[model samples]
Target: MPVAGQTVGIDLGTTNCCVGVWRNNRVEIITDYHGRRAIPSYVAFNETERLMGDAAMSQNAANARNTIFGAKRLIGRKFTDPAVQSNMTHWPFDVVSGPCDNPIIKAHYKGEERHFQAEEICAMILMEMKEITEAYLEKEVKNAVISVPACFNDAQRQATKCAASIAGLNVLRLINEPTAAANANGIDHRGCEKNVLIFDWGGGCLDISLLTLDDEIYEVKASAGDTSLGGEDIDNRMVDYFCIGICEQILRDSKMPKDQVHEVVLVGGSTRIPKLQSMPSAFFDGMELCKRVNPNEAVTFGATVKAALLSGVKSEKLSEILLLDVAPFSLGVESIGGRMITFIRQNNHIPCKKTLTFSVCKDILPSVLIRIFEGEHSMTKDNNFLGEFRLDGVLPLASGQPQIDVTVYVDADGTVTVSAIERSTGKEKKVTVSHDKGLRLLSGRKRGHGYGTLEMYKLSD
Candidate 1:
């Protein structure tokens, strides 16, 4: 029994997950039946049934190979990716390359061998969040605003959305984690101009976002991060963990002087470490780190507020705020001489569309292939291959006779949709390009299954 307007915000983190909702004029963290606010992001399979959250995590010692943690690290990544390959050595569980070259976890469930995509494992965690929310609200809730690291590319973002769909939740939006932290602090509502630095060091990633606020609009100036570096790394080398390198890197990349940053807002559990906290203070020349909001819960709080706003909840404090995000990397397609032609450059304002017109290289071409990629590299081979589609029935015109428009559109949530059109015949071929053909979630491998195709679901506009 889903309530029409029930919406919640989910912080689907690498090391943990939290859900919250706007209630009684403020954000309230939804607790599980045991009254725990934060839940470990772990899923385990055993003799009789699958376990989630604490249940899954507590038994991880005995079921290390069957317990799945850090699935977020594998989501939307190719099995051949250096990062994935590197992580594989440390994980106790087995990961095999899928047909699409994506990583798939293999574990024993009910005395049977089973394989699961990263998206599926994440979906189980998301389903637990949905159930927790439903239990708290006493009604079925479907819509949510989930947060991801600003560094997540198109494929990672779409895979996250796909996980939400599998969990039976409609994503109102996929927000950047640092941006959500800023909202939790009501930075835009402060009504004063300032340059704020948000340092988000979580379990699996560290996102540094520099934002400038004017009136009520918050524009992200620049964002930089190491997707594979986070709190877990710090824990491994607690004695020598210093984020000064990344702090200086972001400042250099954004070209912002340390003194100019009015406030250094800290997000994620890692910021609580005194050594980690001191590094930022020293780097910024002793400015106090803002800790007004709970480091672990700020993301959830902001997401809840955003969910409330999207749900059309009437609240004065939630209104009159605008947030603008940027494209983390340049998006383009393979062109002549194996080069890449960028349609959307890195740091470009999003919810934006850019089009490039071209003609077939061959005089009488039947079709043209659009091999899309994302990165700042000059060649497609050096960039991350996103996906591709073929536009056929081109009318077999001469090299320069046809006008084909290749349009790359990025929505506010950072999901990408690419389309190609032939103006002459008004023929068009469009795709979201985020989902790989071989990596699509298929409804199979059953012991009673209910997985759906990720591309088949889209949140209402």
Candidate 2:
């Protein structure tokens, strides 16, 4: 509502998406054209028309195969990936392999089978947000900051960026979901720093971010969670409990060890369930969860705050705060023995850099290849290969004799750049790793860099 291309923060969740705008010295979540604060993350397509949000959700049952939902899990993933294969059984819609092995949405619309990439479907949802916000502000909306899960790899982040681009929104930044929540609800102190714990259990992912805050300065201390574990898992557990009698089921379920904490801030609509509320009480010793902010809209509210800050908006409150994040996984290259040697470990603050020296494997070679990866896997083949670049002018010596400095820098913009230079010649080459090659599947299981047995690293508290 401020002006054209002004910053708007968007929470593009797997189950629901919300948009917020910063105005009048505060961030306000905008209701959609349908008067809904939280829009269902659904999209339906027919030959004649397309519907989004509640409109699309209404037709999901009748046209289940034509409606796309839960796209966040599939976006940037391959048809042969284990996660994709696991989620396939739950979706009523059809998913097929795409041109590059990326998962594709298959729907029979207007008497024909139409295919759409996950990013394309997500773009439609983002476009809906753009239209609704434009109507509310009575002006064009362009710039936005979208949030993604901390565990999302380069490919997923890239896919999200692509969706925003397709929606005609210029992305200001892609903040992690928990970090955004901490910005919105966890950091409440002024003039002093405090440790805050955020329990972000959303529809598709449960993300826990440990943060330190002083007024507006927010820093992530540690982060851990299960990407596939969230409110939906709780619901499934609830259903299983009820099948055997709720009271009996809860009694049979093993009690989890209680963790010490300061204040537990809960975000996600699923927190509204009475049963979930009851379970956490046992874990937290019955401490009251913070409800000062709306669970459903807190992430978006934080997003708007970020957009306001990033836009250089003039406000005394905005000027006093700082936000910082950490690299979620270890990034490095493969060792000769198939070991993963980490250059950057998890929880290292962002905009950080690390340099590692490497040598050529053979003598008198013209080039040295560095294959970058992200994960906590012990073996290089078990991690996610992001991208690779070569120092072509290398004056190679005997194996393990030549030195090439490989520097990996993850900037504040959430993009990775890897640079390699031959120590002797000072020749260098750099590659910015983002969406395009982030999720490229190695077809042969054997390549220049061995096959990556991709697995989601489930970090526990």
Candidate 3:
């Protein structure tokens, strides 16, 4: 594909959004109309009109219920996920349950009820980035390379792609957040074949990746992350500490209705009391919150660097830069004893393959079970279940004989393919793993048999 004349790099982030354009063989961050390097990813609508960015963030105090923030955590997640339920506990806004139980942000704007899916909220931010790039480059901007956390799963990646579609921008690629940042920083140490670990700490997530750079190819060796750990976690800890101190102070004062006192004390500004500043400072050990990287703006700044590189505006000396990213979680199958036998570790290189051999515990095992799981945990129940498959007709083999060989391959796009062959009969079965919910959302696919309307399932629930 021919590169668009106005290609730009965008960091569509959780708390804030930024845009970068290539110029004079370097990348430049474009300030918004308000002359800010970062624009708050917030939107609000008062009875009179709609507002966005800085103006919208200011309303967080007065209209906390209507202001929308932190939609990134909700993106690409099902309503059934425990993570979603946990996030709802801290969000000040009203999150309405949607189809598939996904959380939808609802607010009143211009005297009318306004509803937005997580995708739409993110699309609005991307569209703002598009406008910033177009105005900065003084041309029509249509194509872009947007970055996402390496640990994001297939559903999350697809959700981001959907957001791009709704924003009317063509995504050149869904680059990994940390890899893009490394590119932005001119880290091309791969010629020496060194193994470098990239630790990405952002407002909403923490991703750690190890890569082996050799010859012009960057290959991921291992990757891991805690999606629920980031700057937000630190902030919540501070908030809770503040709440505790305030409760103590209230108790010291004259006794009042407990409910009334709780209402007055637990709101916004009380959470930011400077007198109890030890909470935030104590959370960070000697100003270093976590090892490997800082949680504040490392990922965002790194993303800006990547955006510049992809725009082709960076110097040719830097153009040869290549980044290889790995899947964030481990891939494995369940064994007879419910043990998860891992084949590919997170952050391993793309276009790679690994195989494992297993013997039938019984003389005539009729069927073999293939349970796929993702996570760093060695135990089967500790990881997320991706899908399952069954291979039949195991040749009547002696107990403890190697009857089947399973080969797993992961492509560059992060698709997983598994093949199982019976050694004695040579019978084989293969399948490409896919999320049941995501497959249904992709256009032009027939609904699976026995599947009913989404509403019917809701009614039964």
Candidate order by lDDT, highest to lowest? 1, 2, 3
Best by TM-score: 1
lDDT by residue (tens digit), candidate 1, 1-461 = 22366899999999999999999888999999999999999988777777889999999999999999999999878899998998889899999987768788988876777778998888888888888888889998879999999999888888898788777889999989988988887632586788989889988889888888776677888887878888877653542443666667667767888888998889999888898788788878889888898899989988888888788887777766789888988999899899999999888888899998988888878788998899999999999888889998887777776489999998899878899998788789998865644334444433333233322211210
User: lDDT for each of the candidates?
Assistant: 0.83, 0.75, 0.63
Between candidates 2 and 3, the lDDT winner: 2
Clash-forming residue pairs, model 3: 181-302, 184-305, 223-346, 223-347
What would the per-residue lDDT of candidate 2 be over residues 99-172, giving only the tens digit for each residue? 66778778765555666678767877887888789889988887999988877777788889877876778988
Tell me the spans in candidate 3 whose CA falls farther than 4 Å from its real position: 1-6, 46-50, 80-82, 109-115, 138-140, 187-200, 208-224, 235-315, 357-371, 388-407, 412-461
Worst 10 residues of 3 by lDDT: 261-270
For model 2 the TM-score comes to 0.87
TM-score of each: 0.92, 0.87, 0.67
RMSD of each: 4.4, 8.6, 11.9
lDDT winner: 1
